[model samples]
Target chain A: MSIIKAVHLRKRFIVKKKEPGLKGALKGIFAPKKIIINALDDVSFSMKKGEIIGLIGPNGAGKSTTIKILTGILQPLSGEVEVMGLNPQKKRAEVVSRIGVVFGQRSQLYWDIRLGESFELFRRIYRIPDEEYNANLELMDSLLGIRRLIDIPVRQLSLGQRMRGEIVSAVLHSPDILFLDEPTIGLDIQAKRNIRKFIREINQKKKTTIILTTHDLGDVQELCPRLVVINKGKIIEDGALDAIVHRLAPERILQIDTDKVKKDFTYPHCKMIKCEENKMWISFNRENVSASKLIAALSAEVRINDLQVKEPDIEDAIEQIYGEG
Target chain B: MRCAVQSWFEYPLEMLCWIIFIPLYSFGGLLLLKVISTQFSEIGGWTFHGLAFFYGLGIVTHGLHVIFFFAVWHTNYMVLNGEFDRILLYPMNPFFMFIIQSFNIAGYIDITPGIIIFTYACLKLNLDWNAVAILKLIAVLIGGTLIRTGIFMIAGAIGFFRDTRNAVTNFMVDFLAYNTTAFPLNIYPYGIQVILTFLIPVGFINTYPAQDFMGMDNTFSIPINLSLCTLLVGIAFFLLAYGFFRFGLKHYKSTGS
Candidate 1:
């Protein structure tokens, strides 16, 4: 069953435009130019329960706008958004109660209080039963090891610790759906690994539906089986992660080390991209020329000592998607 | 509320400054009342004690306004900085969240001097302190707070439309609330009195309520009882202002990330 759906969502913003220099500043006081920005234009997507979907896009591609609209923090100019069979805008309180949100650059925790106290406040705000709240906290502590950091003030916690606390705070009520915007923005490798593991465990243990937006392809590559690519306020591609990667970036680079130098090496269906000294880099589509076949052909022309085939990653696919736009 | 109190205690030096400065500020108003009393028996048919009562009422209501509605002052900054986005994400009314999140405990210091002056004035006036009168006083204080808060809310809601950076709020607080409401409305010209009483309704905060205690006739020909008018006006104005706030929320354009 579809747990969340958005149809033809459109949102725009009117911003004041100012010219350069002091004279323009003075003129702006009386007659400032206004420009309209279509932040989201005809964007649509859907998600089923317990599915981890990655919403990836370039900057200003309306990734955050779409999340805000789903969370009911923003009202789209025109759209139909239904979360758990209810309109998020019309039934905001009910919709918000069933879902959780975390903006990587923004914190929902009180800065002056201990992390535990912030959780306590969230309990009251959501009106979570004491038993359920305690159970959730214990689960979070077991999974993320958040018990020791609870006593520390939120402002004093390092970014990774604070992010963990933020995730705990978001899930204290056991929301059915979680929307994460850039969750692993600035964490170290170990912290990112821990967070990714925690997210996986939560999804498995609670069957929580997750929709994450991020620039980190590692997050998408590891956590999301499905990928939705957006650029310029529109959906560009949406499908299985590997399927989209293959469709957009199918070519692989084959690097060869040879003892003897060949003045000219030519092969059908393959192009030599780079060569220096005893090494040569060749590019060919996997569908057009198999790596083994190309290597077999290359060994006959030159004394190839070693070779490595580099597969195309999501980063390259994403770059290609953005470059096309 | 606990968090706000804890944060307050964390800034000991700042708390000490507020403790000392708030009462001194109220004292300055009292000194002005003293000067007016010496020069003339009454500014607008109000005796020294009666004027003191009115001034004390204004101070108390002002302090309460600061205590309860202090968050309104930061609405512009919140909207501009994307802090309001976080408040909207909570599973509660955004307005309610905004109020409780910034509950200011230090405003208690502001209330202290006002209470002291009010009690002193009550003793001097020797007014009847019956249950009904006490209830009326409570009603007046509550009504006055609602009036101030309503006006401030209107000012703050304008932030949703444009970035005023508290400019409109400052004008409302300094000129309309403190300077205008502190004195007898009758002292102003008739046109000003009408504007204050009915249009902006700052006069209802203290002037109309005090008139009943001072045995003065209703300056305006309004049919409602003078004693109950403040509460009625307060409720009506607050509802209207809140509706305006809701309208602004519909048009709220959160800052871009």
Candidate 2:
């Protein structure tokens, strides 16, 4: 069963024009002008159950807008969005209870209260039974390792500790679907790794459907195998991560550093992409040109000191997808 | 509920301030009441002590509203700054959260002054300290706090739709209007009585009790006083507020913090 189904979910925001100074203010009273900005234009996508999908986009690419609509915080101008077989806008309370969302920097816990109090409050809110409550508590404490921090006031916890506690609070009742926006943002390397591991573990073990929106490519590449790239309020690519990488930049890049410049041997099989500073890089399809043959031909002419293979970065490929479209 | 109240104990400075402020305010209130008592023999048909008694009750009630619903009024600041987005993401009603956030001991400052006036009125009035009067006073309390708190809640709910909640100024205007008019409903022109009893509802907050203790007659005594304007208008205002809140939420564009 598809957990999320959104089709042509158009959200248009009115950009009101503000006049300047006294004269403009006086004129504004009489003739106010508004410009319409299509935040999301004819956007469509569907995610199957237990699928961990990456929602990647630049600023103002309708990432938060889409999430808000799906969460029933805002209504779309037109089109349909269904989460778990319920219209989010019409059935907000029911839909919200089933999905958990964590805005990376936002802390949902009380500022002066301990983590234990917040969890208890959530327990009352979700109306979880004592047995299920203990089970989920044990699971969250192990997955996020927030057991020791439970008694500490939220304001006293370190950023990483606070974020872990926040994540636990979001999923305390074990929501079926989770939306994480920039979850690893502002975290140190070790904290980021822990978060990534926990996210992957839950998706694999609990079968929690995860839709992550992030500008950090490493989070998506490592944690989300399925990628959905959006730009300017429209989706440019939606498929597996490897497919987007291959489609956006087809060939792998090969760099050769030599002691001297190499003679131009336009290998019909391989294409020379760029050459600079006694170094040249070429791209060749593996199926078209054999790596040994190409390397042997290039090395036969110039004394190659270092050779390395590089695939196009997912970040660049997504950016190129935005640029070309 | 228990945990929310316990959190207040953790902040000693905050609770201590409330303990200090409540007495400070009560003492200050007596000084002003004394000035009014000395010059003005009576407001409306009551004696100096009767006016002082109701004034203390009003202050105590106001103090309660300040402490219990302080966070409710502060929601405007929280919502405007986008701090409320986090509260919204929580499973609980954000409005309910604000009410439970703090235990307002801050307004206790007025109790000292209120007690001073009450003690002074008791001594000066020299009335029988009997069961009936005390029971009537208790009844007045039940109605007074409800009406006052109800007004504040209506105003707080109005904040969901407007830029600023300046409706609190109505408190001053209400005190002035009800305190000046001599006698209860009857002495006034029928038109004025109807407006006070039904349309405005401010009269019941204090004047209804003034009639009960003083053995005076009002235009519309017990039944109308407790029924019309106060409770009815209060409930209607509450429903109106609920409507405004849901309407405002649809248009609310919570700013990104």
Instruction: Give the poorly placed runs of model 2, Cα more than 4 Å off.
Output: A12-36, A263-274, A284-297, A322-325, B90-98, B102-204, B207-223, B227-229
lDDT score for candidate 1 against the true structure = 0.88
lDDT of 2 by residue, B1-257 (tens): 55656677788887787777756655555566567657875545766677676566566555555656556455455555555455555455655665666546554554455556666666776768688667656555555555555554455445554444344534543454334222344446778767776655556655665565555777655555342334455455445545655565565455532
Each model's TM-score, in the order given? 0.98, 0.82
Encode model 2's per-residue lDDT on A189-210: one tens digit a residue. Answer: 8888888998998888778999
Q: Give me the runs in candidate 1 sitting further than 4 Å from their true place.
A: none
Q: Give lDDT: candidate 1, residue A64.
A: 93
Error of 2 at B196 (Å): 8.4
TM-score of the candidate numbered 2?
A: 0.82
lDDT values for all models: 0.88, 0.71
Considering just the first chain, candidate 2 attains a TM-score of 0.92
DockQ, prediction 2: 0.30
Instruction: List, residue by residue over A88-154, the lDDT tens digit for candidate 1.
Output: 8889889999999998889988897899989988998899999999999999989889999999989
lDDT of 1 at A108: 88
